[model samples]
Target: GAPVTTALDMSQTQALTRAAAVGSAQARAGGDVVPSAPFLIASHGLLGWYWPVSGKLSVLHSGQGIYYGIVPEGDAGGDNAHMPKSLWVVSRPHNVGSNADAKTARRNFLLKVDASPTEDVHVSEGREELAAVPIASVFTHDAYGYANEVLVADTARGDVLRYALDALDGAASGGGRLPEDDEVKDAHVAMHLFTRKDHINTLLAGDSHALALLHSGGPSRAVLFDKECAAQASA
Candidate 1:
């Protein structure tokens, strides 16, 4: 029998194809050729693919999902329509497998990469440190389709933190000074939004009005957080 061959396309709907050699093993032993039958495995499957701009691939420890959103042009520039977008990635270091320790000394990171039109771009990691592990994240937007804030859910702390987009972009650009200035601050402040007893696995933001947090460790449930509820709680 010939060996099985498999191919996977991450972006395609029919993602996987497995081909098995036809005819008996004795035919190949007798110096005979045989064709192969290809079978398609069909299902609703999701796969993620990333192509690094650089030739090297950098691995993230306990890396979660990658989110894309419009970068709001707040105070940084007057042109709101032409503002660039960005990619948000969250990672929790020292939080998975045998290397995980309860007393591990490391900081979780929420990284932002500017998706500029031109080749000029920079990657920014938030300096506002979180000792807890971040499990999921999402970007909330305003009415004009610009990102308002990014919400990160840390299941280790059982809470969510919201970071303003303007502050994040400002810190990444180093304001009006040189980006290499040590005097330039990169710490983006985060506001504590809410907490939960169950572990949050994912975050979803609705059309400028609502957010949904999905909890999945125990009894699965989703909690909706609306703007009215947030305003009321703040009051």
Candidate 2:
């Protein structure tokens, strides 16, 4: 059968088209909620979700049946309005195959670092690390208000950054682990906040930098994850 194609503005349109085919095959069984996908979005066009397995871009939704729209900024085009040239991943905030106990648990923010497979990252490794610095402050903050704490990531990826950013010292030792760090020594200074995500949009919204602690079966001590990111704009 002939494939459906679109004349999208994306220069990588052909590549993305090929990826869609891959995504359809990898779609998990049933509609179970997924926390995150191992694939990272390569769209890099203002916004789109990408499954690492197939490297396909996903349509973005604001949830509540609303899709995030692009607002063109004069010559910069639609991508200008949103954060352009950033890391992204496909995340599922609902449904859990193993942890069915959670319907609305933390959405999984796929990883920015293309490490080993999800299975390998989970059992093969013991600890991981992720570090990010906002090049600027968010003009708008979430209900949690200004995220004001450093976190040690737990999941094997970035989807959990926002959730973990608010806590100074706490760890989720099972699913995966991130090295916990302290709050910024200079609070007065304006910088990007280190955080986590439980959804696709959330992952793309925050600092794009993230790492994972893959365990290939070791003595279970502690893994170290850290990094600093700076957006072009600063608050």
Candidate 3:
């Protein structure tokens, strides 16, 4: 039998379309790969997508965009087609850091990237997506400058994160906090590599919000909540 064809009206085009991707706790954690759109909050933007071959995240916008991708491998880039997703969510670290040498610089970077309730700063669990290539971020900024050829994989998106850092903020405590300028300047970044594996392996690993929970104190304690999209395994 032949299928019937019909045209959509202007109203239909304007209407919000339900996401085609899957979203469930098992799906998010167990899938090990991002096969479809699940949790997405266009309102909270800062985006990028993954590349399986190289295992890195890339941004389409320059300057202000920071905190590249977080999708893990075996999930992203596993398909081998290596196509970018349409969109993604970006998250800034709670703070940023800079130093004369690698030791100090890494410290500053983690301060901003890690979360702590004692700091009064809140963590925003990233649960958004565009399900397409060329993902972009809405609020991330390059306060420290861009990096060069650094690579990382976003386990959540099954993609990689990439950026070029030119410099670092004075203190790691509030490092991920972008300046009021909305753009990066005098960044003075050097070549270094930061990967999701590094993130997961270290004490500062996991989502920015996850770090917040780890550092929360007393009433300011951190807690997890359902993002509502359903893909999170922990959820």
Candidate 4:
């Protein structure tokens, strides 16, 4: 059987043909003028320009859609009154990811510098506590709405444990078993352990609720818990 070929575009006179190889198909579809750099359409529809030489991409317009063509200011006649007169050009694009990575690295460096064996011990103990729980995976969520407070999920036991960022203080204080199970519960922050017959496949957290996916052979059930309700009950 002959390999099938797809015609991308149609011309009124003659059809444009290409070898249909690697990026050749794209080049044919894009026409004669090929864009050398990336042009990203932001969520809010801003036209961006990427300069490969400087590895920078800047927004050229703050409009709500793609910029088709820009006419020169002197060429605008009386009928072009509806067209945009001025465009906002961005000179610099902030590297947000680089800044965030630096902040995280600094915090981790300080934690290691303190040299508290207890911190390592607590993490080990927490993992050991869930050893029999058969956790498929674990993830953390900002359930308590604090920079430091998090809810760590144990998929095996259908448990979501509260983690106070300040737990480092307990490790710094001295040798003692880290808070576990009931002791970790507080009025507004604590673990929400689910009692279900089915195995937990995954966990999802919403703004005010946590969803647990059950691994039943038939239609799986999603258990939802009001974050506040669960916290108050455990507290």
* Collision count of model 3: 56
Is candidate 1 or 3 superior in lDDT? 1
Q: How many backbone overlaps does candidate 2 show?
A: 29
lDDT tens digits, residue span 1-235, model 4: 2212122223411221333353676665776454543433222334444444445544443332212221111122354343323221111122222223321221110010111112112221111110011111121111221334334443333445544435533342443333223222232243444532344544445576655556545666655566666666665
User: lDDT per model, in order?
Assistant: 0.35, 0.27, 0.26, 0.33
Candidate 3's TM-score reads 0.19
Better of 3 and 4 by lDDT: 4
TM for every model, in the order presented, reads 0.41, 0.20, 0.19, 0.29
User: Mind sharing the TM-score for model 4?
Assistant: 0.29
Indicate whether candidate 2 or candidate 3 has the larger lDDT.
2
lDDT of 4 at 166: 51
- Give per-residue CA lDDT, model 1, range 1-235, as digits (tens): 2112122233321221111233345446766343221111111111112123432211211223222222223231333234333344443333342223324523443444332222123222222211222212222111112256665554544444455555555555532322222221333222234433455555555544534344544655545555434534443
Each candidate: RMSD to true structure?
A: 16.8, 19.8, 20.6, 22.7
Order of the predicted models by TM-score, top scorer first: 1, 4, 2, 3
Worst 10 residues of 3 by lDDT: 110-119
Candidate maximizing lDDT: 1
| Pairs of residues at least 3 apart in sequence or in different chains that clash in candidate 1 | none
The deviation in Å at residue 162 for candidate 1 is: 1.8
Q: Which portions of model 4 show Cα errors greater than 4 Å?
A: 1-147, 168-193
